[model samples]
Target: GFLSGRQENVLRDLRRQMTQAAEELRFERAARLRDQIMAVEQVLERQKVISARMVDQDVIAFVREDGSAAVQMFYIRGGKLIGQNHFVLEGAGEDADACEAVQEFVKQYYQTAAEIPQEVLLPCDIAEASIVQAWLRSRRGSKVEITVPVRGDKRRLVEMAQENALHALEQMRAEMRARLSNADRALRELAEALRLPEPPRRIECYDISNFQSEAFVGSMVVCENGEMAKSEYRRFRIRMHQDHPDDPRMIREVVSRRLSAGLEGEARFTKMPDLILVDGGQGQVSAAAAALDELGLAIPVCGLAKRFELLILPDEPEPVALPRNSQALYLVQRIRDEAHRFANAYRILLQGKKQTRSALLEVPGIGPTRARALIRKFGSVARMREATLEELAECPGMNRKAAEALYQYFRDAEVREEA
Candidate 1:
């Protein structure tokens, strides 16, 4: 969402790449490049020209507080707002000098920058203006001008960037805010951190619960604008590996079923989420990615491991440990936790419901203790029904006769229902 590049420049490069891919008969690569072009065009269409100078420049602003500063940079090419980004500089003096921080960024950034702008706009004059400008010019092989706009549209752009920097600083240092506007900011931060095409307006998080390999279930929790959309919450009864729970395979099944149903025009599955999060690490991410690949859906998928709260992205070697207090971390944790909660709740309900327990008690020699043991061993009434007599008899406190009786009860019930 931030510092991506000048949209037109990106779009031009993407179009060229797309054409090349097509000529090479790499249809998948061409399709991906086409998607990138469309995403950039969507962003470009919403741009508001911040300047009329028709020149390349970098607009810089900063917010300094508590010995730290956040610097926001706007990359303007041909007077259009191409891209923007923010940088956090800690270890500032108690005075929290923004100009010093901004100057430091310029010195370090331009050292290896691929492209240098003709002009650099700053909110205030740095200590060595002439020297810095001379160094920038040397790097650019042309004259570079540094200007501090006093008033007009240029000044307003600085103010806007400064405001954004303040927000960025606040998010990094504090707990997540509940306000809708703040949620919007958190979404933007997440998009930037994850390098998504844009901030996700609708996010779906999936989690699996198979405690003791009993009552396996999958949960799908939705967050719209960073708030839980309870109405959209869904639970899936994992149809495979009831006796032997395979979490990764189950995850693939859940995601595949959900997306396939949506594509099939089911009202409940319609309105696909912009992003998908699975509660796990690489295994879960890979499983979900495999499902998406099979379905030919290019939706972004990630995993959140509970142990370190690390974000595991597809094709990324290492997991991302977000800043402890960042909004992106908070937003992701919120969705992950909700999905876990929903999944566990469904599992608990399936295992503990009195109806299911009572049904077990009806079997010959199945007392309260035996019923509880069977539920723990087999997971649910559904699993018990699917169990073989030998498997049931192997359970604690269950005899062969009791297992036979239990099996017969299920069969007789099925027969009566059929009749």
Candidate 2:
């Protein structure tokens, strides 16, 4: 029943269409076609034969290590292995035994499952085996069994599943090690290229985003050992140069604020970056370095020129240009790009807020004060459009007449959009 004769034909047609759409550069159409292909493929994957006997069953096994647990589930039907999946349990704790973890997993896993298998083979006996059996039987409308196999093919299957889980855990650890090694190597290269005493563990890159003096903002992106540290990223509104838009002056203000916070030991800015990268040439680097000097901090600073990819240092006439394929250059580019993205994202958000506020103000009887209150209460114009007359009336500063007018405004807008 997974794929009817007609369904199979439809799936083949969809796959062909997806290929053609992609070839023709209809990306949006191709994406929809691709999604349809995936849906059919998933059904086919679920219908894979797992046993010659055609008896549906699930083999569950788990391995716990280093404050985490990895659980594997093998789906079998018709004496063949249909599918296998592994899950990682973070913060599983040292005291929890494997049997307890398996029992907990069984209870939660089967709750949302569309089909309850005839049997579930576990790695070890669980206290809630009887209750789980009863629940499965009730849902399946037939007899169901939960067992732990000590010997035979069933036991071999459970052991294999356990091995799969352990293998997944090992792979995760290996990936972690590789990431750390690469980060260390990149940092070392950067330090050697810049003539630093040692590798800089934490680097911060700064960029400014604005549209002709509107929605001016600055972003600071952090990199620790060449990997992005997203939690340490920060954004600042360009308050000082909001009216007079000078990139150098804006960089000075942003760096001054960040350094002042670091000096005062503010939670986010308490730890200073080993190197500060500005997304501009000599002027921006000079401004940032001056700010650091004024604050009496000796943090190393450089600028990445957008046009030439030049690394401009403080008081240096010539820029340092590393090889095109250098790891140090890649790390600097990554951090600079992240800063630009964050600043641009903040600018877009501010633009959206401004547009929404102005749209709300366009409604009759809704002035700036009431518009601000509506935005605060509803969060967005789309949510406000979905609000009922009663809900709008209940908002602070909203009277029945004003609420009715706002509701009517959105209603007319929807009609116009539909037309």
Candidate 3:
């Protein structure tokens, strides 16, 4: 998808490797390579097949506007030629439309092609079969064909095609092995970059969001194998105290409460993550560390500082800078962003509720008890307005007179201020 020269370079390398595999008698590898090439060709051929079928013709060839010629023929989905019988003949005379005839031919042809058995057909043409058989015979001829009539270049071509298929198969297997190895290597590099105790199997990150202790909330997100473990995530509402607004205390309380509750709860944090990350500098890390220490959890903790692209280690004087393109860095960014997103959403929800509560609670007659009763009964002030006086009186400590007064007060108040 880059420069044409780069694309050409890659194609040349692939061709060279394919040729080398074939020469080395690595039939399985060569077959795999051939299959890839065939699959790619099949994808390109989809347009041809679709257009040809729609046009109702056996497309012999087409020249693109760039003057590139492409030949088309019917084939089984498995890449085998469907044979000449696939074509149908139509039109009776000189004006007998050849194009219509070709189209008619292809329609019937494809139907038959779909019914072909999933095996190599015995090449009835001896010339074609013989060419392939001879080439196989040169190597292990007797082991090659059991059904086909064995000839000249056609026979050799068959043998070559078989060889290519076998090589492609081997290449596919080798490619898989190499891919697994590269993945392992990349994982190890990430582990080293993060100074993780081991290649992180799972990680948990925490972030706090608030507007000056109003609507304060914390969010925790989990990642497994460098991907989001959203199902395992948790969120917390800040309830301790608003005066100090200490983040360290907030984080500690969140972790402590979450872990403590997880001990016996359904949504338990029983599976400890390999690492822990906080979306702040050292102070957040220190808070998390203390909480984990108290809990006797030994997971390593670190921080992703917002100011710089540095990973803050516990008790370290300087944070470590990881390469911008590093997978390790990406993983940390994912965790931090997820935590921040969750925390921000939770905070917003709290803010919305707080604003609603402040407006209702500011009513002269509505103290905390009455406001809580109204919220609990009607869920919100808007809902309370829709309620009948009887429903309002149903609320604890709310008499009919008070309920009517409240309803009237709300109706008359203009620009009710939020807390």
lDDT per model vs. reference: 0.84, 0.85, 0.61
Query: Which pairs, if any, clash in model 2?
Result: 50-79, 50-80, 51-77, 51-78, 51-79, 51-80, 52-78, 52-79, 54-78
Model 3 C-alpha lDDT per residue in residues 106-195, reported as the tens digit of each score = 234434443322222222323344554454444432443423325553344344444443444454456555444433444465579767
Compose the digit string of candidate 2's lDDT tens values, residues 103-130.
Answer: 9899989999878889999999999899
- When 2 and 3 are scored with TM-score, the better candidate is 2
| Candidate 2 backbone overlaps, count | 9
Cα TM-score per model: 0.45, 0.82, 0.51
Which candidate's lDDT is highest?
2
TM-score of 1: 0.45
| Model 3, C-alpha of 197: deviation from truth (Å) | 4.5
Question: Which order, best to worst by TM-score?
Answer: 2, 3, 1
RMSD of each: 23.8, 7.4, 18.4
Q: List ranges where model 3 is wrong by over 4 Å.
A: 1-189, 239-242, 263-267, 387-398, 413-419
Over 374-402, each residue of candidate 1 has an lDDT whose tens digit, in order, gives: 88888788888898889998999888888
